[model samples]
Target: MVKYFHNGLDHYFREGDLNKVLSLCLHRFEEHGDLGTEFFIYIENAILKNKEYVLQNLKNMPSDFALRGVVEYGLGCIAASEFRLESTIEHLRNAFSLSMKVLDVFENEHGFCKSVVPFIAKEAYNLKPYDNLKDEEILLPKIKFSKIEKETDFFVLASCNGIYFDRYFEEFYETIRQHNENNIYHIHIANPTSQTEKLIAELDDPNFKFSFENTNRGASYFACMRLFIARRLMENYNCGCLVSDIDVRWIKSPSKIWAGLNKADFGWYPKPGPAPSLLVHAQIIAFSKTQKAFEILEKSNQFLAYKLSEFPSWCLDQSSLFRAVCLTPEAKTQDFRETLGDIETVQRLPDTSLTEKQAFRAFENIEISMNSDGYPILSRVD
Candidate 1:
């Protein structure tokens, strides 16, 4: 079987025999554990060099065909490499809406394909979710999470680069600790500085846990990877999670937001706009403990991995979330802007330029807490 598959790789692909190629690829993947870099390179080269024949055959295949989606993604990769923006978006949107699971094969093909977050955001525009995809048909990255000694009903998740540790960590920590309504706070540190590691060690509170990733991918990459972290934490704690920006200050107990999960698998406030960033605010997003929610998180991780390889820009996190939402239409979601009104449940701290002292000073003499009606309102201190 292995010999037949190995010998037929070139003949099947050149002839645009997608099924035979996919079958052989899957057989190899199942047998050897992974198809590896060599397999992906061949597939990418076939798409890029034989673009017309490969894409025409892929396009002619039925929309429901998994190989069609995989090949279209390869085409998108080729278009992106050549800086063909429109074609990249068109092919990617089709690829996503058709069979996102199949594109996992290209997950390791960063060298062969080029992509940017803006192009991904453009593709997500008007993109529809995969129709009737079974849970078993999806492929998700396997990430390991540390066991939380004490599981809480809710968890607030965030990540930050080592650069912002001293300037923002204390204030961010104090605000959540003081205002938290029985929620566990876990922060993922990306490329932590000495001081960042020291402080987290000194704190040593079970309720305040820390995770670290030793990569110099900067703040945006760290931010984009938070959902994957959140997904892992959810698995460990067996609870709903609210992923937030480190710059956000909680006023009311996010239990109110947690309650919103009863109606949907995911919840976030969307700004009224057409742009991907504006479509979904990433400062605060609530994810329920449901398979649908897990699927969306995994899809977001997949999109993040693909786009970050190109090192686009800071707001790719939001764009990736938007793309995941577009691809997982069955994952019920709630827009908090509608239910919460213009109330201040949480507030963003000052811009990054401001020191922690300045950020705390901004809130001095002002108080925000939950009122009798369970709404967080701002009041002046006497």
Candidate 2:
């Protein structure tokens, strides 16, 4: 039976059959031995189904095994799912330390053991919640916008406080209009103040329509609000949507680039890193009006809500976006930089002298550029 299971497992793994691999791994564990492989399989299944069960299994793991670090990591994931922030951090920190120790022991060991440390470390780091802001109340207004009179190819959704709107909206609107004059832009602002309203009314281009809602002042509110708007645009208008941070600038016409992304359900510029480690920047994302994209957005909305309720952080949106991308098999993403050029953040280009033309020139010349974030300094780039 062991020989039979081994042969079957080898075949399933070779054929890239996930369900079969999981099933066989679980069955193999039922017969004893292969505890490490069993733990991984159990945790993977628990992530999708019963996290409490995974926690119980992890607690039962023997103390001396090298993969006990993985058990701690599983505990961290379970804690995160339960919204136990302190427990989550403690478990993940232990996971990181234990994984490092295991890596040291396997310094000369190649293949699978060598691969484990990086995976453990990265997952542990990613699972750690961003700095807690200690605020969790729904601040967004309940009012909804009626259908607009003009037809639009797409919509851009963003949220900001009064300070950001005052500082950035003019340049953001101007740059977008300069590049995408032909397309109608439905710009929705969440938590708009009187100053923002005045600015929107003054900018009153027929091609640009503004909608506003008042929301609580926090990163979670803004992130969830963006998700809300994205769903509404996709459902009501049945059109493609581009959700961007207020600080993001369109150096070139985004319409053409968006049109070119026919192969993907959604597209975003990835943060620069190794391919497997790369995460999509939530600041600027274009989603096609497909069921797959809609489902991803919907799931992301729920995920952001849960994460915010537990530990509010600026990264909740992007982290939720990353998880949504990972979980949704049908949701395909493309590198938006390939079409529209790389994003530039103020952190990367601190010198104020770099004109918009110079920035575009750099992107066109294949120079490195930073992706957009909530940084106020990025909006100051003229």
Which candidate leads in lDDT?
Answer: 1
Error of 1 at 381 (Å): 48
**Residue pairs in steric clash, candidate 1?**
none
Cα lDDT of model 2 by residue, 40-59, tens digit: 44454455455443445456
**If scored against the real structure, what TM-score would every candidate get?**
0.55, 0.55
TM value for model 1: 0.55
Q: Model 1 scores what on Cα lDDT?
A: 0.60
RMSD of each: 20.1, 14.7
Error of 1 at 273 (Å): 4.2
C-alpha lDDT values of all predictions: 0.60, 0.57
The clash numbers for all candidates, in the given order, read 0, 3
Error of 1 at 5 (Å): 66
